[model samples]
Target: AKLVAATHNPGKVPEIAALLDGRFEIVTAGQLGLPEPEETESTFVGNALLKARHAADLSGLPALADDSGLSVKALDGAPGIYSARWAGPGKDFAMAMDKVAERIEATGTEDYAAWFTSALAVAWPNGPAVVVEGRVDGSLVFPGRGTRGFGYDPVFIPAGESLTFGEMEPTAKDAMSHRARAFAKLKAALFD
Candidate 1:
């Protein structure tokens, strides 16, 4: 079966594809020239379902989507659903990271407690859809570090680890990432 990874972000494609692990030939929504649907949903799971259904309906194939973001405790869980928007039009994460630091600093507290959430949804063209969510608790770092992972990776240090996501090897990051946790559930539900 050809499964659609319902995302326009190039960075997400590889991660999703790896998680799929050859279960099916994967094609990204961007590769299919599918326009990104508006994420009107206020939560990660809601948006994941929306994108999955949209892609499945359009391509007549099963589609998978993930809406993931960082939520900082000090910032009151800000940039949660709006994580992508924080990067602005150019998707400049450096600016976004700086903004996060600034916001935390403005709070006048050093609490960098944060977590990443990943909500994954799988929808068929004419059948029920499955959704799951995962999270990894961590803290934020300033000045950013490394250049491996994308998005806020450079500024996030997962719990029990000293390296940011951007500093860890891909396999290492994948082992404990929010997306991986969500995908584990997905694999069990749909593939196991």
Candidate 2:
């Protein structure tokens, strides 16, 4: 099966490809010359559907898309759908992470409760999209540790782990990531 991975993010592309390993020959939207659709939707699921449908329509193939973000309870869930926006067009996630720390410090927020959320959508050219959402609860840490994963990985401490996602091996992070949980559900629905 040829699946269109409906995303332009270089980081996300390889992760999704790894998840679909041996199941399908994944072709990214960039490979097919498919332009990215505007993520105008308010929620992660909504944005994922938009991207999946756009890619499916343009490529005439089954498309998979996931929209994810870090949501902080102290921040009132801000930087949720806007996680990418926080990094801005330059995609400087380090700066964004710094801003997160600064904001938390300014607000005198001692509670570091937060979570990562991922909403995945699968869409075919002819119709509706199937969406699944998953989350991993954790807390925030300053000075962004390690150097492994991308986007906020350095600052996120999973519920029971001492190492942040950036500190763990790729396989270890993939084993318990929010995206992994969502993909597990998606696999059950589509392949089981």
Candidate 3:
């Protein structure tokens, strides 16, 4: 089976591909030349469905999409849906990390409580769809570490671990990532 990953991030493509067990030939929206739809939805599940449905509608194939983000307890879950926006239009995460650091400093609390959330959606052109969410609680550290994962990976420290997701290998991170959890659910529901 062939399916389209309804995402623009090339980095995410392989992570998702690795989850598949040779049952599907995965291709990204970029490969299919499908335009990314505006994520006007207010929630992660809504956003995921929007993208998946768009791709499935256009490509006439099953489409998978995920809307994931970093939510900080101190910030009242800010940068939740706007996680990507925090990086600005150019995706300059350096500046975004600085902003988070500044916020933490101003809070004056040692607590860096945060979590990563992922909502995965799969849709078929005929309109059937499924969405599931997963989350990993942890904290954020200033002066971001590692250079592996993208976005907020450098600053996030998963619970019970010292190394940030950016420091862990893709397989290691995927083992406990929020996205991975959601993918597991998706697999059980549709694949297994």
TM-scores of the models, in the order given: 0.98, 0.97, 0.96
Which of candidates 2 and 3 is the stronger one according to lDDT? 2
| C-alpha lDDT values of all predictions | 0.94, 0.91, 0.90
Residue-by-residue lDDT tens digits, candidate 1, 18-126: 7778788999898899989999999999999999999999999999999999999998999999999999999999899999999999999979999999999999998
lDDT of 1 at 64: 97
In the range 38-134, model 3's lDDT, one tens digit per residue, is 9999999999999999999999999999898989888888788888889988998889888887887888878899999999999999789999998
TM value for model 2: 0.97
- Clashing pairs for model 1 are none
Point to the candidate with the largest TM-score: 1
* Cα TM-score of candidate 3: 0.96
**Which ranges of candidate 3 are over 4 A from the true structure?**
none
Cα lDDT tens digits for candidate 2, 1-192: 999999888778767977776699999999899998889999999999999999998899999999999998989997899999999899999999998888878888699888999999999998878999989999999888999889999999999999999899888888888998998999998888
The alpha-carbon deviation from the true structure for residue 171 of candidate 1, after best TM-score superposition, in angstroms, is 0.4
